[model samples]
Target: MAERLPAGRLVAAQFAACAANHVLPAGIGASAVNLRFLTRCGLSTARSATALAVKAAAGGLVRLGLAGVLLLAWPQTPRLSTTIPRNSLAIPVVGCIAVAALAVALSRPLRHRVGRVARRVLTDVRAAHGRRSRVCALWGGCLGFALLHAAVLIAVVRALDVTVPAGHVLLAYLLASGAAVLLPTPGGLGSLDAALVLTLTAAGAPGSAALSAVIGYRLLTGWLPLLPGLLVLALLARRSVL
Candidate 1:
Protein backbone atom coordinates (compact mmCIF):
# COMPACT_ATOMS: atom_id res chain seq x y z
CA MET A 1 0.00 0.00 0.00
CA ALA A 2 2.80 2.40 0.81
CA GLU A 3 4.31 1.84 -2.63
CA ARG A 4 1.45 3.94 -3.94
CA LEU A 5 2.90 7.10 -2.40
CA PRO A 6 6.29 8.76 -2.20
CA ALA A 7 8.38 6.92 0.37
CA GLY A 8 9.19 10.07 2.33
CA ARG A 9 5.55 11.06 2.40
CA LEU A 10 4.55 7.66 3.67
CA VAL A 11 7.15 7.82 6.42
CA ALA A 12 5.96 11.27 7.36
CA ALA A 13 2.37 10.11 7.65
CA GLN A 14 3.47 7.26 9.93
CA PHE A 15 5.51 9.61 12.14
CA ALA A 16 2.55 11.95 12.48
CA ALA A 17 0.30 9.07 13.38
CA CYS A 18 2.71 7.94 16.09
CA ALA A 19 3.12 11.45 17.49
CA ALA A 20 -0.63 11.76 17.76
CA ASN A 21 -0.65 8.97 20.32
CA HIS A 22 1.45 10.92 22.82
CA VAL A 23 -0.67 14.04 22.87
CA LEU A 24 -4.07 12.43 22.50
CA PRO A 25 -5.93 10.82 25.34
CA ALA A 26 -5.47 7.06 25.43
CA GLY A 27 -4.41 7.01 21.74
CA ILE A 28 -7.93 7.37 20.38
CA GLY A 29 -6.94 10.35 18.25
CA ALA A 30 -3.87 8.60 16.97
CA SER A 31 -5.80 5.52 15.97
CA ALA A 32 -8.37 7.56 14.12
CA VAL A 33 -5.73 9.62 12.36
CA ASN A 34 -3.81 6.49 11.37
CA LEU A 35 -6.92 4.88 9.95
CA ARG A 36 -7.59 7.94 7.84
CA PHE A 37 -4.01 8.02 6.67
CA LEU A 38 -4.21 4.37 5.67
CA THR A 39 -7.31 5.03 3.60
CA ARG A 40 -5.54 7.94 1.96
CA CYS A 41 -2.77 5.52 1.10
CA GLY A 42 -5.22 3.52 -1.02
CA LEU A 43 -7.01 1.20 1.40
CA SER A 44 -10.75 1.46 1.76
CA THR A 45 -11.89 3.10 4.98
CA ALA A 46 -13.34 -0.11 6.34
CA ARG A 47 -10.29 -2.17 5.41
CA SER A 48 -7.92 0.36 6.98
CA ALA A 49 -9.83 0.50 10.25
CA THR A 50 -10.30 -3.25 10.44
CA ALA A 51 -6.64 -3.89 9.73
CA LEU A 52 -5.61 -1.59 12.56
CA ALA A 53 -8.04 -3.27 14.93
CA VAL A 54 -6.87 -6.72 13.96
CA LYS A 55 -3.21 -5.80 14.34
CA ALA A 56 -3.81 -4.22 17.74
CA ALA A 57 -5.79 -7.23 18.95
CA ALA A 58 -3.11 -9.63 17.76
CA GLY A 59 -0.33 -7.63 19.44
CA GLY A 60 -2.24 -7.46 22.72
CA LEU A 61 -2.83 -11.20 22.75
CA VAL A 62 0.82 -11.90 21.99
CA ARG A 63 2.01 -9.63 24.81
CA LEU A 64 -0.44 -11.13 27.29
CA GLY A 65 0.59 -14.67 26.38
CA LEU A 66 4.28 -13.82 26.63
CA ALA A 67 3.77 -12.15 30.03
CA GLY A 68 1.88 -15.17 31.29
CA VAL A 69 4.63 -17.49 30.16
CA LEU A 70 7.24 -15.38 31.92
CA LEU A 71 5.30 -15.32 35.15
CA LEU A 72 4.64 -19.05 35.01
CA ALA A 73 8.23 -19.95 34.24
CA TRP A 74 9.50 -17.80 37.08
CA PRO A 75 6.87 -18.38 39.69
CA GLN A 76 9.31 -17.49 42.47
CA THR A 77 9.89 -13.95 41.24
CA PRO A 78 9.74 -11.43 44.08
CA ARG A 79 6.44 -9.83 44.87
CA LEU A 80 6.68 -6.07 44.72
CA SER A 81 4.37 -5.55 47.64
CA THR A 82 2.74 -7.59 50.38
CA THR A 83 -0.77 -6.51 49.59
CA ILE A 84 -2.38 -6.26 46.17
CA PRO A 85 -4.71 -3.40 45.35
CA ARG A 86 -8.25 -4.48 46.12
CA ASN A 87 -10.14 -5.50 42.96
CA SER A 88 -7.36 -4.10 40.81
CA LEU A 89 -7.67 -6.72 38.12
CA ALA A 90 -11.29 -7.51 38.83
CA ILE A 91 -12.40 -3.92 38.43
CA PRO A 92 -11.29 -3.65 34.81
CA VAL A 93 -12.78 -7.03 33.96
CA VAL A 94 -16.06 -6.11 35.60
CA GLY A 95 -16.11 -2.72 33.92
CA CYS A 96 -15.57 -4.33 30.52
CA ILE A 97 -18.38 -6.78 31.17
CA ALA A 98 -20.71 -4.00 32.24
CA VAL A 99 -19.89 -1.95 29.14
CA ALA A 100 -20.43 -4.99 26.93
CA ALA A 101 -23.76 -5.73 28.57
CA LEU A 102 -24.87 -2.17 28.10
CA ALA A 103 -23.87 -2.30 24.46
CA VAL A 104 -25.83 -5.49 23.96
CA ALA A 105 -28.89 -3.98 25.54
CA LEU A 106 -28.62 -0.98 23.23
CA SER A 107 -27.76 -3.04 20.18
CA ARG A 108 -31.10 -2.48 18.51
CA PRO A 109 -30.87 1.27 18.81
CA LEU A 110 -27.20 1.26 17.86
CA ARG A 111 -27.91 -0.82 14.80
CA HIS A 112 -30.48 1.67 13.66
CA ARG A 113 -27.92 4.45 14.00
CA VAL A 114 -24.73 2.76 12.83
CA GLY A 115 -25.71 -0.47 11.14
CA ARG A 116 -24.26 0.58 7.81
CA VAL A 117 -20.92 1.44 9.38
CA ALA A 118 -20.72 -1.88 11.22
CA ARG A 119 -21.72 -3.91 8.20
CA ARG A 120 -19.21 -2.10 6.06
CA VAL A 121 -16.44 -2.84 8.52
CA LEU A 122 -17.41 -6.52 8.68
CA THR A 123 -17.52 -6.80 4.93
CA ASP A 124 -14.11 -5.19 4.58
CA VAL A 125 -12.56 -7.51 7.14
CA ARG A 126 -14.07 -10.51 5.43
CA ALA A 127 -12.71 -9.38 2.11
CA ALA A 128 -9.30 -8.68 3.56
CA HIS A 129 -9.21 -12.13 5.17
CA GLY A 130 -9.73 -13.69 1.77
CA ARG A 131 -6.28 -12.39 0.93
CA ARG A 132 -4.46 -14.91 3.09
CA SER A 133 -1.02 -13.55 2.39
CA ARG A 134 -1.93 -10.06 3.60
CA VAL A 135 -3.47 -11.39 6.79
CA CYS A 136 -0.38 -13.50 7.45
CA ALA A 137 1.91 -10.55 6.82
CA LEU A 138 -0.11 -8.37 9.15
CA TRP A 139 0.17 -10.85 12.02
CA GLY A 140 3.84 -11.50 11.31
CA GLY A 141 4.61 -7.80 11.46
CA CYS A 142 2.72 -7.42 14.71
CA LEU A 143 4.63 -10.22 16.41
CA GLY A 144 7.94 -9.00 15.05
CA PHE A 145 7.28 -5.48 16.32
CA ALA A 146 6.49 -6.83 19.79
CA LEU A 147 9.79 -8.71 19.92
CA LEU A 148 11.74 -5.67 18.73
CA HIS A 149 10.13 -3.50 21.37
CA ALA A 150 11.28 -5.86 24.13
CA ALA A 151 14.73 -6.10 22.59
CA VAL A 152 15.07 -2.32 22.75
CA LEU A 153 14.32 -2.44 26.47
CA ILE A 154 16.93 -5.15 26.88
CA ALA A 155 19.43 -2.87 25.20
CA VAL A 156 18.44 -0.10 27.58
CA VAL A 157 19.24 -2.39 30.52
CA ARG A 158 22.65 -3.10 29.10
CA ALA A 159 23.29 0.57 28.39
CA LEU A 160 22.52 1.37 32.02
CA ASP A 161 25.33 -0.97 33.10
CA VAL A 162 22.81 -3.22 34.75
CA THR A 163 24.14 -6.77 35.10
CA VAL A 164 20.77 -8.47 34.97
CA PRO A 165 20.54 -11.31 32.49
CA ALA A 166 19.21 -10.49 29.06
CA GLY A 167 16.40 -12.97 29.53
CA HIS A 168 15.36 -11.30 32.76
CA VAL A 169 15.31 -7.90 31.13
CA LEU A 170 13.21 -9.19 28.27
CA LEU A 171 10.76 -10.82 30.61
CA ALA A 172 10.50 -7.75 32.79
CA TYR A 173 9.88 -5.56 29.75
CA LEU A 174 7.22 -7.86 28.36
CA LEU A 175 5.40 -8.13 31.69
CA ALA A 176 5.63 -4.42 32.39
CA SER A 177 4.38 -3.47 28.94
CA GLY A 178 1.46 -5.85 29.25
CA ALA A 179 0.53 -4.38 32.62
CA ALA A 180 0.85 -0.82 31.33
CA VAL A 181 -1.97 -1.39 28.85
CA LEU A 182 -4.43 -1.55 31.73
CA LEU A 183 -3.65 2.06 32.59
CA PRO A 184 -5.62 4.67 30.65
CA THR A 185 -2.72 6.99 29.85
CA PRO A 186 -1.80 7.79 26.28
CA GLY A 187 1.07 5.65 25.02
CA GLY A 188 1.21 4.40 28.62
CA LEU A 189 3.33 7.53 29.42
CA GLY A 190 3.75 7.81 33.20
CA SER A 191 2.20 4.41 33.80
CA LEU A 192 4.65 2.61 31.53
CA ASP A 193 7.62 4.35 33.09
CA ALA A 194 6.53 3.33 36.57
CA ALA A 195 5.83 -0.25 35.52
CA LEU A 196 9.22 -0.61 33.84
CA VAL A 197 11.10 0.80 36.83
CA LEU A 198 9.26 -1.42 39.28
CA THR A 199 9.52 -4.55 37.15
CA LEU A 200 13.21 -4.04 36.48
CA THR A 201 13.90 -3.34 40.13
CA ALA A 202 11.98 -6.46 41.13
CA ALA A 203 14.07 -8.44 38.66
CA GLY A 204 17.17 -7.67 40.75
CA ALA A 205 18.56 -4.52 39.20
CA PRO A 206 19.53 -1.77 41.64
CA GLY A 207 16.63 0.62 42.16
CA SER A 208 18.53 3.69 40.90
CA ALA A 209 19.76 1.82 37.84
CA ALA A 210 16.29 0.57 37.01
CA LEU A 211 14.83 4.04 37.20
CA SER A 212 17.62 5.51 35.11
CA ALA A 213 17.26 2.77 32.52
CA VAL A 214 13.54 3.39 32.23
CA ILE A 215 14.12 7.10 31.73
CA GLY A 216 16.77 6.48 29.13
CA TYR A 217 14.63 3.95 27.29
CA ARG A 218 11.74 6.36 27.07
CA LEU A 219 14.01 9.17 25.93
CA LEU A 220 15.45 7.07 23.15
CA THR A 221 12.22 5.49 21.99
CA GLY A 222 9.72 8.26 22.66
CA TRP A 223 11.16 11.76 23.13
CA LEU A 224 13.95 11.58 20.59
CA PRO A 225 11.53 10.75 17.79
CA LEU A 226 9.00 13.46 18.50
CA LEU A 227 10.53 16.43 16.66
CA PRO A 228 11.55 14.52 13.57
CA GLY A 229 8.17 12.85 13.48
CA LEU A 230 6.35 16.13 13.70
CA LEU A 231 8.51 17.65 11.00
CA VAL A 232 7.78 14.73 8.73
CA LEU A 233 4.11 14.97 9.53
CA ALA A 234 4.01 18.60 8.55
CA LEU A 235 5.97 18.00 5.37
CA LEU A 236 3.56 15.28 4.32
CA ALA A 237 0.51 17.32 5.22
CA ARG A 238 1.72 20.29 3.21
CA ARG A 239 2.02 17.99 0.21
CA SER A 240 -1.54 16.70 0.81
CA VAL A 241 -0.51 13.14 1.53
CA LEU A 242 -2.04 13.24 5.05
Candidate 2:
Protein backbone atom coordinates (compact mmCIF):
# COMPACT_ATOMS: atom_id res chain seq x y z
CA MET A 1 0.00 0.00 0.00
CA ALA A 2 3.04 2.26 0.41
CA GLU A 3 4.96 3.68 -2.47
CA ARG A 4 8.48 2.41 -3.01
CA LEU A 5 11.24 4.73 -4.09
CA PRO A 6 14.28 3.78 -6.11
CA ALA A 7 17.44 2.82 -4.25
CA GLY A 8 19.04 6.16 -5.02
CA ARG A 9 16.02 8.04 -3.75
CA LEU A 10 15.89 5.89 -0.64
CA VAL A 11 19.51 6.74 0.17
CA ALA A 12 18.79 10.40 -0.46
CA ALA A 13 15.82 10.31 1.87
CA GLN A 14 18.03 8.82 4.59
CA PHE A 15 20.58 11.58 4.23
CA ALA A 16 17.81 14.14 4.25
CA ALA A 17 16.47 12.54 7.39
CA CYS A 18 19.88 12.85 9.03
CA ALA A 19 19.95 16.48 8.01
CA ALA A 20 16.51 17.05 9.42
CA ASN A 21 17.54 15.47 12.69
CA HIS A 22 20.32 18.01 13.03
CA VAL A 23 18.02 20.85 12.07
CA LEU A 24 15.00 20.03 14.22
CA PRO A 25 14.35 19.76 17.92
CA ALA A 26 13.27 16.78 20.09
CA GLY A 27 14.49 14.37 17.41
CA ILE A 28 11.32 14.93 15.42
CA GLY A 29 13.19 14.98 12.17
CA ALA A 30 14.71 11.56 12.71
CA SER A 31 11.39 10.12 13.84
CA ALA A 32 9.59 11.57 10.85
CA VAL A 33 12.11 10.18 8.44
CA ASN A 34 12.12 6.78 10.08
CA LEU A 35 8.34 6.58 10.00
CA ARG A 36 8.30 7.59 6.36
CA PHE A 37 10.89 4.96 5.54
CA LEU A 38 9.04 2.21 7.39
CA THR A 39 5.77 3.12 5.74
CA ARG A 40 7.49 3.01 2.37
CA CYS A 41 8.68 -0.45 3.33
CA GLY A 42 4.99 -1.45 3.63
CA LEU A 43 4.48 -0.95 7.35
CA SER A 44 1.29 0.74 8.54
CA THR A 45 1.34 4.14 10.22
CA ALA A 46 0.75 2.65 13.66
CA ARG A 47 3.46 0.04 13.22
CA SER A 48 6.04 2.56 12.03
CA ALA A 49 5.35 4.95 14.87
CA THR A 50 5.42 2.13 17.39
CA ALA A 51 8.70 0.83 16.06
CA LEU A 52 10.30 4.25 16.30
CA ALA A 53 9.08 4.80 19.85
CA VAL A 54 10.28 1.38 20.93
CA LYS A 55 13.69 2.02 19.38
CA ALA A 56 14.04 5.34 21.19
CA ALA A 57 13.01 3.88 24.54
CA ALA A 58 15.41 0.97 24.13
CA GLY A 59 18.28 3.28 23.20
CA GLY A 60 17.62 5.47 26.23
CA LEU A 61 17.64 2.46 28.55
CA VAL A 62 20.92 1.22 27.12
CA ARG A 63 22.55 4.63 27.49
CA LEU A 64 21.35 4.90 31.07
CA GLY A 65 22.76 1.47 31.89
CA LEU A 66 26.06 2.35 30.22
CA ALA A 67 26.26 5.56 32.21
CA GLY A 68 25.71 3.66 35.45
CA VAL A 69 28.45 1.18 34.60
CA LEU A 70 30.86 3.95 33.74
CA LEU A 71 30.14 5.73 36.98
CA LEU A 72 30.88 2.57 38.97
CA ALA A 73 33.90 1.41 37.03
CA TRP A 74 35.82 4.65 36.65
CA PRO A 75 37.47 6.40 39.53
CA GLN A 76 36.96 10.14 39.77
CA THR A 77 40.12 11.88 38.68
CA PRO A 78 41.54 14.53 41.03
CA ARG A 79 40.49 17.28 38.61
CA LEU A 80 36.83 16.32 39.01
CA SER A 81 36.93 16.10 42.80
CA THR A 82 36.27 19.75 43.46
CA THR A 83 33.54 20.36 40.86
CA ILE A 84 31.67 17.03 41.07
CA PRO A 85 29.27 16.40 43.92
CA ARG A 86 29.21 12.87 45.28
CA ASN A 87 26.17 12.86 47.58
CA SER A 88 24.02 15.84 46.67
CA LEU A 89 23.26 14.74 43.11
CA ALA A 90 21.93 11.35 44.12
CA ILE A 91 19.17 12.78 46.31
CA PRO A 92 17.54 14.76 43.51
CA VAL A 93 17.87 11.83 41.10
CA VAL A 94 16.29 9.44 43.56
CA GLY A 95 13.55 11.89 44.43
CA CYS A 96 12.67 12.42 40.80
CA ILE A 97 12.50 8.70 40.22
CA ALA A 98 10.29 8.21 43.26
CA VAL A 99 7.95 10.99 42.22
CA ALA A 100 7.68 9.60 38.73
CA ALA A 101 7.01 6.10 40.02
CA LEU A 102 4.36 7.34 42.45
CA ALA A 103 2.61 9.34 39.77
CA VAL A 104 2.55 6.37 37.42
CA ALA A 105 1.25 4.10 40.12
CA LEU A 106 -1.54 6.45 41.15
CA SER A 107 -2.79 7.29 37.67
CA ARG A 108 -4.86 4.32 36.63
CA PRO A 109 -6.46 6.15 33.72
CA LEU A 110 -3.08 7.17 32.41
CA ARG A 111 -1.83 3.64 32.79
CA HIS A 112 -4.80 2.26 30.93
CA ARG A 113 -4.30 4.73 28.09
CA VAL A 114 -0.64 3.80 27.79
CA GLY A 115 -1.47 0.12 28.07
CA ARG A 116 -3.67 0.25 24.99
CA VAL A 117 -0.93 1.87 22.96
CA ALA A 118 1.60 -0.64 24.24
CA ARG A 119 -0.65 -3.54 23.31
CA ARG A 120 -1.21 -2.19 19.83
CA VAL A 121 2.50 -1.61 19.35
CA LEU A 122 3.26 -5.14 20.46
CA THR A 123 0.67 -6.50 18.07
CA ASP A 124 2.26 -4.63 15.21
CA VAL A 125 5.70 -5.91 16.14
CA ARG A 126 4.51 -9.49 16.36
CA ALA A 127 2.75 -9.21 13.03
CA ALA A 128 5.91 -7.98 11.36
CA HIS A 129 8.99 -9.54 12.94
CA GLY A 130 7.46 -12.27 15.12
CA ARG A 131 10.42 -11.64 17.42
CA ARG A 132 12.55 -8.76 18.67
CA SER A 133 14.78 -8.61 15.62
CA ARG A 134 13.65 -5.13 14.59
CA VAL A 135 14.26 -3.78 18.05
CA CYS A 136 17.64 -5.49 18.13
CA ALA A 137 18.56 -3.96 14.79
CA LEU A 138 17.54 -0.53 16.04
CA TRP A 139 19.64 -1.04 19.16
CA GLY A 140 22.63 -2.03 17.08
CA GLY A 141 22.33 1.10 14.98
CA CYS A 142 21.99 3.31 18.06
CA LEU A 143 25.05 1.76 19.67
CA GLY A 144 27.03 2.19 16.50
CA PHE A 145 26.15 5.90 16.34
CA ALA A 146 27.06 6.39 19.99
CA LEU A 147 30.44 4.78 19.45
CA LEU A 148 31.12 6.96 16.43
CA HIS A 149 30.05 10.04 18.34
CA ALA A 150 32.43 9.15 21.16
CA ALA A 151 35.21 8.65 18.66
CA VAL A 152 34.53 12.13 17.31
CA LEU A 153 34.78 13.56 20.82
CA ILE A 154 38.09 11.81 21.34
CA ALA A 155 39.44 13.24 18.13
CA VAL A 156 38.32 16.73 19.07
CA VAL A 157 39.92 16.49 22.52
CA ARG A 158 43.17 15.21 21.08
CA ALA A 159 43.21 17.96 18.49
CA LEU A 160 42.84 20.52 21.25
CA ASP A 161 46.04 19.19 22.89
CA VAL A 162 44.11 17.73 25.78
CA THR A 163 45.21 14.51 27.40
CA VAL A 164 42.36 12.44 28.86
CA PRO A 165 41.77 8.76 29.14
CA ALA A 166 40.03 7.40 26.04
CA GLY A 167 37.59 5.45 28.16
CA HIS A 168 36.73 8.47 30.23
CA VAL A 169 36.18 10.62 27.17
CA LEU A 170 33.97 7.96 25.65
CA LEU A 171 31.94 7.66 28.81
CA ALA A 172 31.59 11.41 29.18
CA TYR A 173 30.49 11.83 25.59
CA LEU A 174 27.94 9.06 25.89
CA LEU A 175 26.48 10.45 29.10
CA ALA A 176 26.40 14.04 27.96
CA SER A 177 24.91 13.24 24.58
CA GLY A 178 22.30 11.08 26.22
CA ALA A 179 21.43 13.87 28.63
CA ALA A 180 21.12 16.34 25.75
CA VAL A 181 18.12 14.36 24.55
CA LEU A 182 16.19 15.66 27.56
CA LEU A 183 16.46 19.22 26.23
CA PRO A 184 14.87 19.63 22.83
CA THR A 185 16.90 22.04 20.78
CA PRO A 186 17.58 22.08 17.11
CA GLY A 187 20.26 19.44 16.70
CA GLY A 188 20.78 20.00 20.42
CA LEU A 189 22.38 23.21 19.22
CA GLY A 190 23.07 25.24 22.34
CA SER A 191 22.02 22.56 24.77
CA LEU A 192 24.32 19.88 23.48
CA ASP A 193 27.25 22.29 23.23
CA ALA A 194 26.82 23.33 26.83
CA ALA A 195 26.33 19.78 28.07
CA LEU A 196 29.39 18.47 26.25
CA VAL A 197 31.57 21.35 27.36
CA LEU A 198 30.43 20.97 30.95
CA THR A 199 30.86 17.22 30.82
CA LEU A 200 34.38 17.39 29.38
CA THR A 201 35.38 20.07 31.87
CA ALA A 202 34.00 17.98 34.71
CA ALA A 203 36.03 15.09 33.36
CA GLY A 204 39.18 17.19 34.06
CA ALA A 205 39.78 18.84 30.70
CA PRO A 206 40.59 22.56 30.85
CA GLY A 207 37.47 24.64 30.28
CA SER A 208 38.86 26.44 27.25
CA ALA A 209 40.11 23.22 25.75
CA ALA A 210 36.82 21.54 26.42
CA LEU A 211 34.94 24.34 24.73
CA SER A 212 37.14 24.05 21.67
CA ALA A 213 36.63 20.32 21.56
CA VAL A 214 32.88 20.68 21.84
CA ILE A 215 32.84 23.23 19.02
CA GLY A 216 34.92 20.99 16.83
CA TYR A 217 32.79 17.99 17.56
CA ARG A 218 29.62 19.88 16.74
CA LEU A 219 31.06 21.24 13.54
CA LEU A 220 31.98 17.78 12.42
CA THR A 221 28.89 15.94 13.50
CA GLY A 222 26.10 18.49 13.21
CA TRP A 223 26.99 21.45 11.06
CA LEU A 224 29.24 20.22 8.29
CA PRO A 225 26.81 17.85 6.64
CA LEU A 226 23.76 19.99 7.23
CA LEU A 227 23.65 21.72 3.87
CA PRO A 228 24.51 18.63 1.90
CA GLY A 229 21.81 16.70 3.68
CA LEU A 230 19.28 19.39 2.93
CA LEU A 231 20.27 19.34 -0.68
CA VAL A 232 19.73 15.61 -0.78
CA LEU A 233 16.34 16.09 0.80
CA ALA A 234 15.44 18.59 -1.86
CA LEU A 235 16.51 16.23 -4.60
CA LEU A 236 14.43 13.42 -3.16
CA ALA A 237 11.42 15.64 -2.70
CA ARG A 238 11.62 16.87 -6.28
CA ARG A 239 11.80 13.28 -7.47
CA SER A 240 8.71 12.47 -5.41
CA VAL A 241 10.71 10.10 -3.25
CA LEU A 242 9.98 11.75 0.08
lDDT, candidate 1, 65-147, per-residue tens: 77667667766664632112325555887999799668867789765646676677677566656777766766677778778
Reference-based lDDT, each prediction:
0.73, 0.74
Q: After superposition, how far is residue 22 of candidate 2 from its true place, in Å?
A: 3.1
Best by lDDT: 2
Q: Which stretches of candidate 2 lie over 4 Å from their true place?
A: 1-11, 77-113, 124-136
Which parts of model 1 are misplaced by more than 4 Å?
A: 1-10, 42-46, 78-90, 111-123
lDDT of 1 at 63: 68
